[model samples]
Target: MSMLEPQAPDLRVQKWIGADGESTGPLKLSDLGSGPKILFAFQHWCRGCHVHGFPTLQRLHSALSPRGVGFAVIQTVFEGADENTFEKLRVNQLEYALPVAFGHDEPLVGATLPTFMEDYRTRGTPWFSIIDAGGRIVFSDFHLDADRIVKDLELV
Candidate 1:
């Protein structure tokens, strides 16, 4: 969202699915305080997300999760509500072998955009963001550069 200072965005997730594929109930960004945090925004029906975004995330998680980088996935259902249902959160987690907390940010009001997309000012799916341990927005972009992310994670 073109943040000038290092500030964490409001995590307005409607539902949550834990790493164990179980409901975690509602949660906020403050709830996750385990070192560096990486949040990946995707939609199940997005072809690019399935082909590239998720694979990149998986690799990033493989490399950083061991290094104490907390990972989370948010299904920002900006479109394709039928395809990107909350049930797919679990399915995608298992399918992608992602053992990280997953969130379902459904659209509100007249069904325009999900809370994450609107609050984070995400253009569309395949968005990625990172917050350092100090709760600063270190990285936010549509492209995922694994090496750059690893470098940024060091600041946390």
Candidate 2:
């Protein structure tokens, strides 16, 4: 299946603990205020995710966050690892303060690896979903482009 087109209302994400061990909401789409919310879904083991996605995410975070945009990275994983394992995931490599959430701690309700693969219909890492402050998805892609993203978000 291909990526689902942006739908109505807001995507109801599951809440989870951030890399800092802070409890947060399901990355709610409506909480983005009048700005944009960029969600980066990826895994630590994904080489592309680390090499390309994370850095780009960091750039986006640094560029858009001060502009009232909510940037977050959701670390999708099948394993329920401990803090040590998560800490070793190298979240700091992003070089920004973007929060990271794991599926191990906050499994997507009614969604698994196979299911997500079938749902989002992507066979890669760094899947992105950008929701506008009005609780509507304006963009969704599997790759990152810092300048383009900022421009698309109207931050620049």
Candidate 3:
């Protein structure tokens, strides 16, 4: 890849917080199974995350997981530190009935934003990023078109 072509940063997230259901570890982007992977960035306190973000993610996961699409959820806590605690990761995971791995992201020592947010350059909670089969971030934004994703993955 050319230097000008940005590559997907290796995922450096907090521990994989799991409750009951099975989940993959605090893995890098390359660690995800071969095929496209979706990274759902959220915060427990964000109503938008529950009302829109997760529902969007759930549709994508339910439709594409069986088709070899990998999924991971990260609670990037740039704010609401008390409400968006590590414990809430599992709560959201179970609440959504999403069986994929969940991560908790807090600001690193001396840093204002979590590692994932800094690496991905995310704006805020309810962000979504998609890493392609070759580990390239094909899409990164706050809003998603669940139907478009489902249709697009059908082609992939």
Model 2 whole-model lDDT (C-alpha atoms):
0.59
> What tens digits encode model 1's per-residue C-alpha lDDT throughout 9-64?
66878799998999987767766665878889999989999988998899889988
Off by over 4 Å in 1: 1-3, 154-156
TM-score of each: 0.90, 0.67, 0.92
Q: What is the C-alpha lDDT of each candidate?
A: 0.84, 0.59, 0.85
Off by over 4 Å in 3: 1-5, 18-25
Per-model root-mean-square deviation over C-alphas: 2.1, 4.7, 2.1
> With candidate 2 superimposed using the best TM-score fit, by how many Å does residue 134's alpha carbon deviate from the native?
2.9
Ranked candidates, highest lDDT first: 3, 1, 2
Q: In what order do the candidates fall by TM-score, top score first?
A: 3, 1, 2
lDDT of 3 by residue, 6-65 (tens): 578988995776435454467676555889989999999999999999999999998999
Q: By summed lDDT, which 10 consecutive residues of candidate 1 come out lowest?
A: 1-10
Q: For model 1, which pairs clash?
A: none
